[model samples]
Target: MAVFTVVNETDLAQWMRHYDLGEVVDFRGISSGIENSNYFLTTTRGAFVLTIFEKLTAEQLPFYLDLMRHLASHSVPVPDPVPRDDGALFGILHGKPATIVTKLDGKAELAPGPEHCGEVGQMLARLHLAGRDFKSHQPNLRSLAWWKETVPRIVPFVDGAQRELIVGELAHQEAFFESADYAALPGGPCHCDLFRDNVLFAPAAPGTNHQVRLGGFFDFYFAGCDKWLFDVAVTANDWCVDLATGRFDGARLTALLRAYQTVRPFTPEENRHWRDMLRAGAYRFWVSRLYDYYLPRAAAMLQPHDPTHFERILRERVMHADASPLCN
Candidate 1:
């Protein structure tokens, strides 16, 4: 969501001509993520997010855009991609592939409790189910294959301990991927990057029974077809872990997993492979953060996440694999 390619108001106003979105009132660069150029765009018609693809090509975009449209249509709370006047989901802007999606209401619940995690769990389950019939077949770009390709690229930049941990973890993942248990796990289109910041929540209305409700999930750029357990692991690794220690918060973890289970029961294979899947989730982010920290792309507001954060997480998951139960 970094601003790699700056879009001025005049440029955006001119681009808005392609849509019936009325005149652009204002737009500003968003600086949280490291991948693409993102901005909050407002027009007379409504609020939207403008994203300029940095690495993803036009050929690879339909999978993501169409997936979002599919989930949105199925009543999932996700940002819906807006079409151009000519009916294309995306078109070139500033010589790069760009598109607009309706901005979700509310903000990220960074410091969440059990109730919040419960809502997230339920929504994520619904998201996975809603995406079942989506026909696109993009692989998770940052999965095992990517780790194999990327580990060597960042090896020279890491210390001996970091190098050893990554190499060993990668080898373990390779073997696990070859196992029948891994193969038997239920698979689907997954939000592979459903970190705490990717979700939004708002306080419940005055008469509501809950403290807050999930506004929506956003940032579908990292989504792909993968094991559903892997998605659950990725989400739990963030939403249910203590920031200081990288240890699972038992109450929150239980709430989240139970809520998700109510929607979609876990398969026996998923239960058997749960711990390793957690390690895999941690490893994925560690590799990516290391790469982004050591080899960064230039963006106007880019801030690479600290690689050590996930290093601590991976180490914790490796050391305390049995410390938390999978679900109720």
Candidate 2:
């Protein structure tokens, strides 16, 4: 999270009174992401995360805050938003919608092994199934519609070949989404941004061979209604591949799908359209990185990620996909 708005301790401590939580003990800006202004806050009661909405307005926040509440209600491991005495999930702080959620206990498994990937897959399936009955309906903000609109904005910054690839891939994904197979895909509220850093894993007991255990998922601001397959694809494209080479790691990929299938069986159409979904997932991030890289918002500790990383990933997924029973 970036540091877009600075919150003085006096102002923050004053804001803390609305909830039953005690005096603010520690507050520090989180510097790992580009989306929102986030801080790790500790009170006499417990540790929590403070987030100030950067792009989303107060009106647009209920969807995410409520989604997490719903997921927690369904026994999913999510950080439920802390409500104010007035029973609101958010309050205005520094003139932006601000929220606090209980901090999950663990660190992200950035270099996840097959077991970690399996855990993620199972958890993601649970998350998707848990949101099946959520009341709100917000379209995925960065869906195909967004890609179509965003590509033009970033086109002027790329080379001719990169431009052609972006245009061609968009058209490909557009046609794919319009096809009958896409209609067959299941839709639900999805944790569309389940990258490694968003998940947490705690260390196991000293003697055990197992080093870590899944804690919970957070950062639900990117949550949206989208194809479940797209969610799976988004996660696989990150947790099941080599970061340096952009190649699919077969063992991790297989482990991930095997666990995911145990929770929710995939339809034959999903298997047939798996490759296309993977490509679309890659395209989504590639477009986003380009947007952030070329046209960025001002925020402290915000560094635009390299757009070419996902472009390389898109090329690899296009060229070298593995065959598995999940896709058969």
By lDDT, the best candidate is 1
lDDT of 2 at 317: 73
Global lDDT scores for all candidate models: 0.89, 0.87
lDDT of 2 by residue, 52-145 (tens): 8888898899999999999998988888899998999999998899999988888999899998988889989999899989999999999999
Q: List the residue pairs that clash in candidate 2.
A: 1-33
Q: Could you tell me every candidate's TM-score relative to the true structure? A: 0.92, 0.92
Model 1 sits at a Cα RMSD from the real structure of 2.2
Candidate 2, residue 293: how far the Cα is off, in Å: 1.8
The stretch of ten residues in a row with the least summed lDDT in candidate 1 is: 319-328
For model 1, residues 1-328, the per-residue Cα lDDT tens digits are 4687998867887788888888788788997776788899898999999999988899988999999999999999888889999999999988899999999989998999999999999999999898889997989999999999999999999999988999999999999999999989988999999988999998798988988888899888899999988999999999998998888888999988999999999888887778899999999999998888888766522666777888998998888766545542
lDDT of 2 at 64: 94
